[model samples]
Target chain A: MVNTRNMVADNYTPESVAEAVRKYDGVRRKQAIGSLVRSLHIDNIDVVASYGEDAAVIQNGRTALLLAADGIWNKLMEVDPYWAGYCAILVNVHDIAAMGGRPVAMVDVLSASDDAIMTEVSRGMHDAAVAFDVPVVGGHLHPDAPYNVIDVSILGVAELENIIYSSKAQPNDAIIAAIDLKGRIHPSAPMNWDSVTMKTSDVLRSQISVMKDLGERHLLTAGKDISNPGVIGTLGMLIESSGVGAVVDLTAIPRPDLDALGITFEQWVRMYPGMGFIMTANRSDVETVCKKFRKTGMAAQVIGTVTSTKKFTLVKGEQETVLFNFCEEGITNI
Target chain B: MVNTRNMVADNYTPESVAEAVRKYDGVRRKQAIGSLVRSLHIDNIDVVASYGEDAAVIQNGRTALLLAADGIWNKLMEVDPYWAGYCAILVNVHDIAAMGGRPVAMVDVLSASDDAIMTEVSRGMHDAAVAFDVPVVGGHLHPDAPYNVIDVSILGVAELENIIYSSKAQPNDAIIAAIDLKGRIHPSAPMNWDSVTMKTSDVLRSQISVMKDLGERHLLTAGKDISNPGVIGTLGMLIESSGVGAVVDLTAIPRPDLDALGITFEQWVRMYPGMGFIMTANRSDVETVCKKFRKTGMAAQVIGTVTSTKKFTLVKGEQETVLFNFCEEGITNI
Candidate 1:
């Protein structure tokens, strides 16, 4: 693997990166999920798992049914309705992919202030649905609503034994970051890394199926898709869900040429990649898992190691800074 | 069956009821769906049926996965956040039930303006989920959105051969309206008929399972839950989807004591019932289907007959008026 440590800008430090991620809106918004979980929780015999996971796993006879929902941020809807709509479907598909399931179909609920906004949002959703090969089956539309919002929910299926869960990571496991790094930062949404949009359906499907292959092979202990919280924050969530912590060498994270792209390492770690995953696997199987992802044209490498301590720490050469202490304050507060 | 034809208020007319329903906001809001459907449509091999159905049927091996979504109206959220949240889950559960599927779990996307609204919405969602016996598996929450909106999606399972579809109504079938007339008008939201809230879980489950039982027995030709568009408007949608039409007798509708409840017949027909369904079945099996619903405490009646006329008409004794001519204008425009 190429060592990106020397290419890091001299101006950056571990403390700055930690502080920036902890204070970021993407990470901060996750705190609300804890209380919402408490309010919405209900017990059912069929649910194998629910809250705090990428997708809830429900036992449907011999199959594990995966269900997940995601809503685009209102800010995204206002700035670019088309991108917002596209991201809504993209995120839900990733939720299932993160769980090592085959996404079957999606349903959407769209509320728009006017017809123009609705049309643009639909166009974006249609394009993404076709690209993902997941049909937008049926949904509700509020045509004359006072505000615009797009929310998509997906259903997926997987074998019960092969399902990957977020809360199953063990201490001493290798933390790997796999990202498709061959695309530019989205112009419409700067915080978005537009990798998947330019890729063909075959490439996208192959990348998504890597997680499933790993699950079937029992290569992953835990996995989660890197989302709006970015790579580090997403890793924070995965460790938090597993009731564990991790220590990362910041420079080991795979990325395109940061110097040529004119983006600092700090900003790059916080941008939501179009296709990315942070996973945990046994040290012995780490090479095989990374190779599978690499075969799909994604850059994969071991970025961190799961730790027994309940504190997430970032290390940059000699400097080390703690980001989140799960024993005190959690990321999603789960 | 009780015939209350003479109990109809003297001031009502086929022309007036038809006009009021044709102009109703609940029906008008659905007109935007046709264009939205055209925009979101995508073909997938696994999808058995989608779009114009109550729940999309996705074939997963031997199981048919039912997927559907609903967003609570902003007006409901503003008037009463609790009801809005409750209805979000309620509508999704109904969507699956209307398709004769056993709802497994649900996920939601909620955007609240403040913590208080979120808490209230959560309470409502929690109560309804418990009442219906379906767990809220997982969801996304926007804690700081400018507007409050609650959208929920459900996953259910059914035998592929036993799945009921809204687009399968045969011409000349009996149109059945099954509703629990034991409910009073909701105080906070006048347009809502509160029925299931006070019922026990056993009663609620029994009411929901009636449709599934009908489907398994192949007793219904087509079915859809009566939602915000009320009875006639919902039937208009079913006929519109099936590419058929219907003629209804106004006095045959099942309703509570309107005079005692201080409401008019026209208003009662437009009120959204807490537990209701509109179905089409063969003329010979209509009595058996109505009896099944009645055993579960709902008032089931043959309110209309499906026709190939491509026009929806309402008749009062000797007078008849066309509410919607599917050949010209359509409700839901689908």
Candidate 2:
């Protein structure tokens, strides 16, 4: 969520780690969401949920229609149009999958000042769409805009009973962290861990559908895809929406060789891996849920426990520190 | 359609009106569509239709889920932030409505460099969403992006049998034009006709549902909402998509007082009226379709005839002009 820190307490004090996460740009940017949602009115009775979930769920009898949109950050686009396009589709597909839905189709809105960038972006989008087996059906394009931006929206279908809502966490539920640990940081964007790109379509599809399986089995109480705000910040948003918090064990978070990768614990927690999830499950169901993710070749472990205290705390060895006090300041404040 | 003139052969040459519509920026900008769509592949069995419709129709059980995305022009965003925001929602709603579906919800991806523009844009979107009764359920925001962009995606639903298609216009069908004439040119953008802003939500809702009613009654062979390409260019796209031709009488087009508004007949014909539609219907059902629109306080007329030939022609008095020959060059070749 912030600056990298070594394992030693002397090198990374709990208070300092807490302060750095509080001041990170990823967490700070989410503050605008509260005002944006406040300005919108929910006049549609069919809209079952909005704003706080990864994707908005609309009622269609027993079928739930999932809709979500994601835009590439300008910096990300400037760094690599190909990755930007890939992430555009990736994030949108994740939004639907996070809701335990199978993505149907995607529509993109792209604006580019030049053809070279637009071609690269479209190529990236095409390759990712094919890899995920999701079609880019249709979209609008601004061929001569002054800047480059790619925004993608996906439609997914699921049963209403099977939705894995971010607001359904129970106080006693165990928080689980699942992430693919076999990828290197993207050469262009250091914050991204590129795990899906090298994987086959069959493997990637199975990995994504694990959430749906978990939902169908009702193993997880709540779940969310890890995004730009990273695991900790994403968890903050999820538990905040659930009106709860947690005490996380930093040492228990699933990780690769951090020292070998040359990324500190703080940065590792903040990195947006190509495939990752933060989920909550009942204590007895925790092993099965983790096993489901582990079967997809992802490392899944119990990282913490949901709490009624309305605060997020991190524990390492004998030291513990409060990361986010939901009762005071919250990420996304929704 | 172009300048109004006497029905005499010497009054208006076919080449002149053809030049006017062909030279329009709206029509010219759409030329990029063919290339963009060619780069995308649809592997999903559920996608019944895609690029050639107002909204891409996806099959699900007995229902049809409609998904469409639209991006506001940067020029519009720069000229009027609120209008751009409003149009973002307004246009997305129309895409669903044009496809004879009831819009359920919407998601937006917005990037604003400053607070004031963002606030105004959100206000515009909120007001439009409220008027249309569609919720802005969820979206992604780039709070600190370097540029301004507003892209919106909408979800709509309809019975599979009742979905209207842009690519289904039949030869010998009566081409109908419907538009609310009770509006002035928007103060900020000259090409926009401000119609919906002054109307009640009830009135606006009825105006939008006329197409739905038409669908239920099986009154239209094909349909498309009048967009930035104005009545003529939109019709060209519709006819091109349908693989048919059309002969539109210049005199029959619905319009406000061009002279009083101080805009020429040419200008009015190219304006994007806030509430307008171009539809092809059975010759016998044309009256019923027009009557439905007239009942909603919009002018409705049988302005054209669909033909087997792949050409669009305009007529006034004894003069006839070919607007577009789809067999050669076309607008949005998709």
Candidate 3:
């Protein structure tokens, strides 16, 4: 393997990375999410929490039912139908996993204009479902639709007390980011890293279970799976939700060889790694939690610290830059 | 109020009704549904039934969790976003209700190209949510989408033993169609018969409860709510699912004043009457079931009889036309 240590040392620039993340489409698309939540929200008996969280929690007697839905962007669908279908299930599963819940089943609503596209999309969905051991139970199909769109919603169950939320991070905690950097960028979709698709099911499941273990043991105060917004942007969202701030050290983030991947340091911070998460843990529990992710074949590093000030800052050696100020300009406005 | 008896006597024409139902857009859109189902289907453990059924059933413990998603057509959304949103929730609730299930909660994925459209859609969704008493728990939003769309999926629960299925109808059964004809066509949406919106909550709840009562009492063998395909087309689907046939006497179908509404006989049969269902039951149980619907402020009529041969026929006096033959041309091919 090419040495990543030197590349990490050479690219420790604060301004470049912040600018790339600020302009990333993955991060920009989320600006309207908060306003949409405000418009659609309604008071009800069963709902515990709706928007501003990974999964909506519904009270179901002794257990809490987690409900969440995600749609693939049209741009992605145009580039790769299979990846679009796979991501539809992948992102929804992560939504449940991020909330400290066990994914039970999923249903999909697919609207495609042609048969060839539908076959490829369903193949991707089926393969992912089998690999994750989660069934695609039932869904609606619009075969003669005018355009191609895939939307998936998942249901999961969790103990009411054991659930971890994005809005619960505490001050003075360590921000830990864990990611599998063994795979290359997907050929069909440049923004996606193809780590889980090539890896054995055993390895993928183990990586997913690490989050559950952390939640069960109460090791993480707040956590989120690294999604379309990439690692730093995801951490920014968690910090925003928790009403706190974070200071991240650019050199400490784990990454693969930048030269071999033919990508810049700024691009890496904005790309969606196939299997990754950003979490906040108490200073005392940080080491043990990082050790668990490392055991699952991921590079785990304590790259930042949670702060009391409502500003997200990026630090590279002596240089520092403000990434987000939650008090002024919000990410999701949640 | 007009004399119902005189109106019914002057407007009944089986040949005209058959032609109208055959050409209705609600009935025409369903022709493509079966081909789509055939393409997307895959083997899974939890999925009990899909496609031609009202709601897809997933096995969950001793009970079954009914899951379904529905999206309003673009034409409807352009004309009335509020009605589009209302129908999105209305259709999902009906899917579960048709299956003898109790709806628990729902999640929506909404995309709007403009603010006025988004506000109207949300207003309609909020009103229907309160009317049905099923909360909109959580969902995703695409605030800057190029096109407008509203897709909703619901979760419901039913006892495995009491869950009604569309494939359980038997030969020699009486076909019972129940509809609330106490309202006029919606001015904004001509195809939509505005029944439940004008009724009191008590009346609306009772109308929905009639299906659950039928399932619990084992009064109906197979059933489905009248959807875009209207009354006759909905019955055609039920017959197809049951692997049987049906024959209806045009004189027996209940309808409002066709002359006053300025709609032809064919249009009335094909129009999507809000809060309508077509069910099959033994001759002995027909009267009792009709009484239950009538008590809920609906008009119930024994319109047809189930047959062993797979053919759907409509007769008015001596004139008859074959609408569908499951052995030859199936509606949904369930």
**Candidate 2: tens digits of C-alpha lDDT, residues B1-334:** 5554532322334567677778988778888888888887757788999998999999998899999999998989999999999999999999999999999999999999999999999999999998989999999999998999999999999998999999999999999999999998999999999999999999999999999888887889999999988998899999999999999998788978676687766777778899999999998898889999999999999998999999899898788878888898889877
C-alpha local distance difference test of each model: 0.91, 0.89, 0.83
- Candidate 3 structure quality by residue, lDDT tens digits, B246-324: 8998878898877878876677777778799999999999999999999988999899899998989998878788877
What interface RMSD does every candidate have? 0.7, 0.9, 2.3
User: Residue B331 lDDT in model 2?
Assistant: 91
List pairs with backbone clashes in candidate 3. Answer: B26-B228
Give the lDDT of residue A43 in candidate 2. 64
Task: Compare the candidates by TM-score and give the number of the best one.
Answer: 1
Regions of model 3 farther than 4 Å from truth = A1-12, B1-25, B31-39
Who is ahead in lDDT, 1 or 2?
1
* Least accurate 10 contiguous residues by lDDT in model 2 chain B: B4-13
Encode model 1's per-residue lDDT on B232-252: one tens digit a residue: 889889999999989999989
TM (chain A), candidate 1: 0.97
Off by over 4 Å in 1: A1-10, B1-10
Listed models, DockQ each: 0.90, 0.79, 0.50
